[model samples]
Target: MTQQPLEPGQAPAEHPDAVPLYGPRYRENPAEIFSELRRTHGPVVPVLLEGDVFAWLVIGYRELHELMGDPQLFARDSRIWNQWPNIPPDWPLMTFVAYQPSILFGEGPDHQRRVDAMSGALSEVDQFELRARCEEVADALIDGFAGSGEAELMTQYVYSIPVMTVAWMMGISTTEIDGVARDAVAALDGGEGAPAAYGRLAATMQNLLAAKRAEPGPDVTSRMLAHPVALTDEELVPDLLLVALGGQEPTALWIGNTLHLMLTDDRFSLTLSGGRQSVGQALNEVLWENAPVQAGLGRWATRDTQLGGRHIQAGDALLLGLAGANADPYVRPTSGPPANNAHLSFAHGSHGCPHPAPEIAEVIARTAVEVLLDRIPDVILAVPAEELTWRPSFQLRGLLSLPVKFSPVPATRS
Candidate 1:
């Protein structure tokens, strides 16, 4: 499931100890690999990405925190990467680093503008209404399989909730939400069909933009278009794409991973009797431990700098190892909840997930979990806890599937 060593030789990185960040070893479990990498190479480990492309993973909590705060030293623009020549145009991971005019690569003043506008629009979403909408989405999804007394929650349930909720928030009709959500998840998978899937998403957004521009509504798209910053349709399309993506995939994974934790971990077994609050608690714990986004495209070194005891050269890519940072032994306590919510799950700094985006995601995720538990109180893992397989993705921490069994239940009374 990997490619032959691309380039001059087997060793693609400057550090001799650089290890491939793919293959069976990593797919089995990345925590142990991150631990070993930290132990062997310190906080900043030199690693080879999917195609043996050299990059640095910042695993230390302190180093990652500093990088997020100091964008001057490590910028968001990935076009400065020195290894671009060796990377293929169709590299599966290119969606992360490719130079797009969107907010992902925005810098300084302009980036702040985009962040402000997006945050303003997201803040306008009524939390009460959003939670209600998410509950509806969850209940409808569960109704499809609740009668069978079983379901593979990942694709059937987990992936649909956030995408459908976000798509609805964009004012898409119910009929189109399913198809858009499917294509969006495909795009997020970054697989062979991702380009086409992403193209379809952009086209959908283009159509939405046209509709919103002509006649605005109280939805997210209309709010962004009506923002005083005066974003053109071009700017809105990509920003909307980021909203659909940033809002969908990670949030979906957040719910799925947390559900995985609740079903598999004994600590949460007691909450299965239709508890609602535990959903939020489990969501928080998941953020601290198995952050949905394990890493990011990360910042390019603005100039030669020393960090985590490693001398980094200019233009070197320093990926934010979110799961690694959250698990740093120096910061995380052994037997209790971490002292504070300092985990880098949503990232930090100005470029971090915009102000209200995290809140919106949590609402979507929490309600999805709560509604499912309320409807199917006795859901249990269909497979042994250890038998579940993690998705073969270094970027996202999610399961390939979450098979579960529950008693048959009639649809909601509402």
Candidate 2:
């Protein structure tokens, strides 16, 4: 199916603020739409994406939560692909198999079964081992650019960490992983972005699957092969790629955003190093205020239902505002700090992303922080926060470049 241009030019429309907030093509600051509708249309508002399909935009946290709780009513299955006429057959499959369920995108008994398999994989020993490996990778990557004083964090350090970690987890060798990782990132280029990246990822996974089948190793991909309900290479590659894309790109954005946010805000900076409790809270706030993913886990309405006073018909594709819902004042009473509100950065309910690769991820994130502290402790932004280039993406929002400056650390410390 050919994708309709939702917002062709993507500029603001003629109606002005009084009418529906419209953008020329794709949604710009969708959060703004949700915020505006919160006052005017209740929590849910009837919205059109690319100006074609009629979907509900869920702005409020409570309403979003309720919708996610019932998988049957708000399904996240094959129906979502039906709504996107743009996804061509050549599109790269997701990095991991999402359809068969893996903790991020599954339903019913199959969903539970996948969750159980993943839970076993997340044992304490496995986590500790991954952490050790991630720390080494983090140190090597960050150290290489530490002397430069200012580096493109996302491209240089952010994307590298997760890609390397996920690649290693899949049993891909370090020598070949860089090329595969680079191609994997490309697969996520949908629409105006690079479309063939997905295909490359699928191909690479296919090769890896064949290799593993002949001689399975101790990696996650190998364990997946041992599953009672094993998926074929063709079936698993796309979902695996999706997992890789979701795990890598969004994570890279989150890490970069966190650093940038903390650098600008004193409250966040103060609490960052105060152990897991403080760092955890700061991470929560960053995830809420500046998540890599802008839209919520998508769902296609199974039946006509009234949500937030809006008539949602069956087959309508709904875009829930994970960030907006997290910040919604009507949902939770945020008292002590900004981080206290329950956030949907990882999505929520049935399709929520399991903290897969949590230990490795945390080690990498913390090591990035440590590297900055050790190399350039007093680093400050060279430009205003607003001046930073936010990559124009509705699905993923992140800083394209963040310039900062500081005197280098002493020779001994460096």
Candidate 3:
């Protein structure tokens, strides 16, 4: 059944973490705040996170599962989103490139076509190949810090692998691709290192797209260019840039977050080391427990609809929480504790992130580390957990640094 539109004067639930989007509380402890709402307001609650505009906040996992998949009830478009006051200029550009029009963001036939085009080369066999390549990349990166006994896992390990793999797939030189990916992700929030980095990354993707047009290769960009979908130069360039840039950082962070959580939680650590299925289960736990995208999902109400019993009007921006939904007890009954089910790190429905492949890769990558740790009994945290600095961003989740020490078992005195 399609969800109904929101009605007027249905005030947002009063919660401490319920604040304007610009506030730090929104960035810092969104899940905590949303949890409060879920308890107080039930599954679907009213929210005003984006600005003063009201939209439905889908708190329960089941609601998100239904809402994200049902296009007739909920809609996404760059234009409908622009009406909100205080909307960022780059917001539309980023949304269009990163989410809307992208396969995950598209509705109806356009979504299917775009997905088919890009996914042809990303088959299960291709995914295996990507995993193999990622394994090699992971080896080289981990080796770089092997002798040091301590290294920033995010910069040196987590961030490097996906960017390199994506670049390799795209036929971009690893040297150029890694730096560009790093700079672009750093610039996402338009902060200190953001402006210059964003510019360079943007220019690089634009140039590469042009190059691909003239001489297409086996990469995703080449495939996209060959697709039947009509893509403007404006759309194609920034869109590819957004994909290449946005893809790697979150992946890297999730990997880091998983590792960080595993090392900290005894039960999680034991499960991850159990076996393949155990590791897979543990991976799901990590995704839910430490989801990288801390903020809720973003959407604009197309027209008035009654969702979760609240009245919402057209142009209402719904900032649904991915992490919140996954953790909700209603979604997955709390069996013993909060670690039973896989987290909603990827999201639900047609618009959910197409990251099962990468997520699998991330699990394998982190599990490999666990395997190594088991093999090497002396591996230990070289630095305090508090010393680790996580990347500061409302959109992405990851660590900035993870320094650890390992005392390798002495070479057997043969």
- Best-matching candidate per lDDT: 1
Of candidates 2 and 1, the better by TM-score:
1
Provide the lDDT at 205 for model 1.
91
lDDT of all the models against the reference? Answer: 0.85, 0.62, 0.59
Identify the superior model by lDDT, candidate 1 or candidate 3. Answer: 1
Off by over 4 Å in 3: 1-18, 21-31, 45-56, 88-105, 187-200, 228-235, 268-278, 336-343, 355-377, 386-394, 408-414
Ranking according to lDDT, highest score first: 1, 2, 3
Q: What lDDT tens digits, residue by residue, belong to model 2 across residues 25-44? A: 22335456556667876777
What TM-score against the true fold does each predicted structure earn?
0.95, 0.81, 0.79
lDDT value for model 3? 0.59
Regions more than 4 Å wrong, model 2:
1-33, 80-106, 122-125, 268-278, 334-338, 355-360, 409-414
CA displacement after TM-score superposition, residue 86 of candidate 3 (Å) = 3.4
The TM-score measured for candidate 3 stands at 0.79
Residues 1-414, candidate 1, lDDT per residue (tens digit)? 121233733454347778777665655678787898898999998888877788889999999999999989999889888778788878877777888878888898888788878888999999999998888889888989988999999989998998888987888777788778788777777777777888898899999999988999989999999999888888888899999999988998999989988887777877788568677778998888788898877899988889999988888888899989988988988876574777889999978889899999999998888888889999999989889888777788888889999899987643
